[model samples]
Target: MALIEYRFDNLRHDRIGSRGIDLQSLDRRSMEQAIAELRALASQKDITFPRLPEAPVEPIIARAAADRKDFSDLLVIGIGGSSLGARALLSSCTPGNPGCRVHVLENVDAHEFERIWSGLDPERTCVNVISKSGGTVETMANFLTVRQRLLDRFGVQGVRDRVRVTTDPESGILRAFAQEEGLVTLDVPPGVGGRFSVLSAVGLYPLAMAGLDVEALLAGAAAARDAALAPEAESNPAICFAAHQVALHDAGTRGLVFMPYATRLFDTALWFVQLWAESLGKVRRHADGHTENVGPTPIAALGANDQHSQLQLFMEGPADKCVLLLDVEERRDLRVPAVPAVLAGLQHLEGQSLDDIRAAELRGVRAALTEAGRPNATLSLKDTGARSMGALLMFLQCATGLAGSLLGVSSYDQPGVELAKRFAHGLLGHSDHAHLRAAADRAGQGKALTSVH
Candidate 1:
């Protein structure tokens, strides 16, 4: 069996509840009705259910990887979905491998700009300035700052050659600027939101630069898409997984803790948190027009590290939390150590090798979590490669969408973010709302704002 199938089989046997739900119990007529409703809801508005790209993105990624593009580092400038997904992919594929670093500048902190500038060599660095709209203040501000820095370090000629753009084709200012300057460009497809653009070229370029196998990644994603679309409940892993999570939430577990064993996946957890929180968070109105809060609270934790910190709260605090553990079958390329003479007489300790100790530790953690009845699920990646990471990304996206549907919320829209954006713009003197600006000025006046409480 392929590695993907084996890992999935292990998940099925070890994680899924054997008898909690059966499709047959719903009656064929009722099952059809539920599916029809789900399909209709998924298709409504600009929401497009996940689908495999008609032309594979692998070859394109491979070409990018093989190109003679000489750049020391690729500076990705964007916020939220524009930057998070690509950062997750790059971090996972090369956990500790030291190559050209993929530095993502998502925030407008001046200190971050100073740090990036300190490390970057303008002559060798390539900048990928990404924004769906030409008008995101944070992104545009960062772009201008970085461009000026590059021009100062090198001449105008160098700035023009090193800067690239990824944005909407015809409408955005960035797109127009790239065209005028003759800089290389990637098109961000219209109608696809930033959160949903990971599988698109937005993520492909960075993954290629990180030396991941893009083809294998796409294949795994394609397999996952197929499974999500399957009719059979047993064959469809995404549907089964989503149904279980929904059942758990309805039964009173509304908080989700994403715990990944490897430190590199910490950023991936953040991305998932945004996807789940933003997508499902909404004020839903009933037949009588009554509204209610209907989204899960998401938290991210790194394993081994969090095993010391937050595990206590999770284990004893409330029974209303569900944990998802992302465990890898093997780390990229670390070898087992040889036995030493630190301990003399423990039965297995004297002769056991390092691999034995590592394996034992992994087994102990899984067994302990399972015994605690924490309602935990594990995603086992065969190895941290391009394909495995790609498959994982697609799997989580589909699972989250299904979970949202089960909870009766739209998983693609994020209307709550607008309020914060409006507030921030007013604070920055970009909005016409005078009251908001006045409030922001008063809030910024206090010494407490600069000090840690």
Candidate 2:
């Protein structure tokens, strides 16, 4: 059986007619063009993550095994794309190791910094600092601080044993340090951007080190890539999905709701929020240099839980949102024994399991949203296992790439984020950015008073 499935049946486009996107019309208009764009991206050797699952990962696997034997705690340092995908996979698929806990420091904020360190015994923990260019400020800052602690406790040998660097193959500062210090290292692959690097060493090495089935995850992602690459517009889920959603965006749908029924899949939605927001939210276009505010806002919600919270506003507030629901089928279903009901009218739920209630609620919400004229779709996962999670991640990633193609935007580059990085680097005393430092100093003078209230 296929490990995952994608369907638009709940979209009710036939009944909604013009309000919901007509896929046939979308196919007639832009299917070939979108496929070509996606194919062009796939052909680029620099962007190899689409095929990363099938690539050699033995080096990552071997090092992970070695690290597993040596350390009782693991810490990963990075920000944004560098850490989100890895964090999501670790939380979703890996059971907590009673002996070794994993911590990902994606923030340098004081509270976040203290919280991560407070839980760890510095002597036994291993730190994997990841950044593609080896120049990311937050990552390097965390690495330097943690590196001194490891050196103080275990000396230079401990620093070499406990620290691993994942970065560019030959050129980056991290790679240079690894060569000089005899530290184990993994390449982040040449063209893979941070947001698109989950399948690369950025994610796989940490997963392997934590004793998860990374091979199975990659196999699942490979299967999804093959499915997404299918040439036919109607048959290829990724292309078809992008066409539909982009059409909705054209029709003024500004918000995207990702509501998952399973607790384990919550991080998956959070990961997508970054992927979609950073990839598609853009100012420039490949078509005639068109510049206008564009892109869909991704909103995350959990089923049964968020139904009581965000659904009210989502259903009744505006006509400008679309909802994607994730329904997970568990491999092992627990049954509830017949028991006395707590309330007089609630006897009907006495013997039904919690999963059954969640499933029923999914159906109810879908029906309600459909009747309210809200455009909605559902992604059903076979199980909450690694393969299923892997397939889901790949499906959305391909869809993001395809959507960028349709919009004529460069999905891989994040220009807005880079400007902020430059400003922060200047403020942090980069010699090449004196002007930036002066402007930041000016900007900070009046900003402090804003915080007083």
Candidate 3:
């Protein structure tokens, strides 16, 4: 199994000066307690993600293989947690010659959806509709639109052969539709929510269809799960990371910049943004009936690229942010040719591989941030393989859960998101959500408005 290396030296005051975190002053007891709580949570039957790696994958693999044999393209329809995890996996693992072209219909934008839909050959396309609740508007809208197109082109039997659905096994409108249509289906596991469903059929099915190694991916996640369960906080990378983040948050750090050096892992950073923001950002109600808004803002950035774009603000902006740098030690490489004599000033880069320059840039940024007294840390992978990506994703998920515990928030629920969804449903004229629509209209009645032409 490939393991990720967690380095926190740059986050320490001794290394990054006064503005950095001081290990001696950290709340060790609170962190330990949080980890203990997370351990218990993991052992609970209702928290199913930690056990996802152990679920049987034979059925998923068989289905994917069949899809690969029959289809030239696979369209994954879903949004947010439903689509982000699969995007992260495919972006990072399905490079080179993918077995089938995988396109994702994650948004409800008509133009984007039309582009993807129009490009696909209906006869050779497989549609995978994924929604744990079977009720997400964006996901359902896109899937319904595509289903209509498939029905027009292939008829009912053809639609059944081409469509696959992953939803709640025991309930959900999508499940009922699948049964009514006799479409092949997979379960999203009883307790595994969308954000935590990657290791389950949600991710494995698509990955298998792409001819990637699902077993290796699960192995890496399992390894990460074991490491996160270590008895000592220092021995568990996830706990240690969560503890540092909590300490930083206590010190008024509000923004977390998740910058990954590799372009492929940029999607992984976005996936982390959702996991961290949705899982941690919450209104915590105390025993006294008072509520406080909690959780840090997660900023996703691509390194080397963001170094040119957002690095300036980070270096000199408010001391309200901490940087988490992601490094992939090995990558596909290209050597820079020797600089021409006329361009002698740029000779320093001559004969250096692109990866070498990227390493230098990462190191220089770390040093510069340290000199500026801005706290930062790095999480590194030996290579951008399936195992490494799995470990990276699991580590972030574990850290998010632990950090939520430390912050005294419910990690599994997103009440704020649901409130927004209710408003959207109301706006769309859903009878049950009419009250939410009225509330939204009332709130918007006298708000100032601005327009630009």
Question: Which lDDT tens digits does candidate 2 get at residues 1-453?
Answer: 467666676455675555577665675447767777666667777657687887788988888887788788889999888888878887778543333467899877878888999999887788999988888888899889988888888999989888988999878888888899899888888878888899999988878777778888888898888888777888888887787788899888888899998887888889999999999998754457657767889999999899999999888998888899888776445666665656677677776878998899998998888888788888888876678778889889999988887776777888878877888989888887757987777876764454455
lDDT of each: 0.68, 0.82, 0.86
Error of 2 at 376 (Å): 0.6
Count: clashes, candidate 2 = 0
What local lDDT does model 2 show for residue 195?
Answer: 87
Best by lDDT: 3
- Candidate 2's TM-score: 0.93
Q: Give the candidate order by descending TM-score.
A: 3, 2, 1
Which parts of model 2 are misplaced by more than 4 Å? 27-29, 45-47, 94-100, 286-289, 335-342, 441-453
What is the C-alpha lDDT profile of model 3 across 1-453, one tens digit per residue? 247999899888888776778888767788788778767867887547877778889999889887898999999998888889989989988543357888999878999988988899999999999998788999999888888988898899988999999999889888888898899999898888788888888888877888888888888888898888787877889988998887888788998999988888899989998999999999888899999898999999988999889999999989888999988888556989979889868998888899988988899898898889898999889887788778888888888888988889978888888888889999999999987877888887875988899
| Order of quality (lDDT) | 3, 2, 1
Better of 2 and 3 by TM-score: 3
Task: List the pairs of residues colliding in candidate 3.
Answer: none
Once model 2 is optimally superposed onto the true structure by TM-score, how far is the C-alpha of residue 42 displaced, in angstroms?
3.0
Which residue pairs clash within candidate 1? 217-387
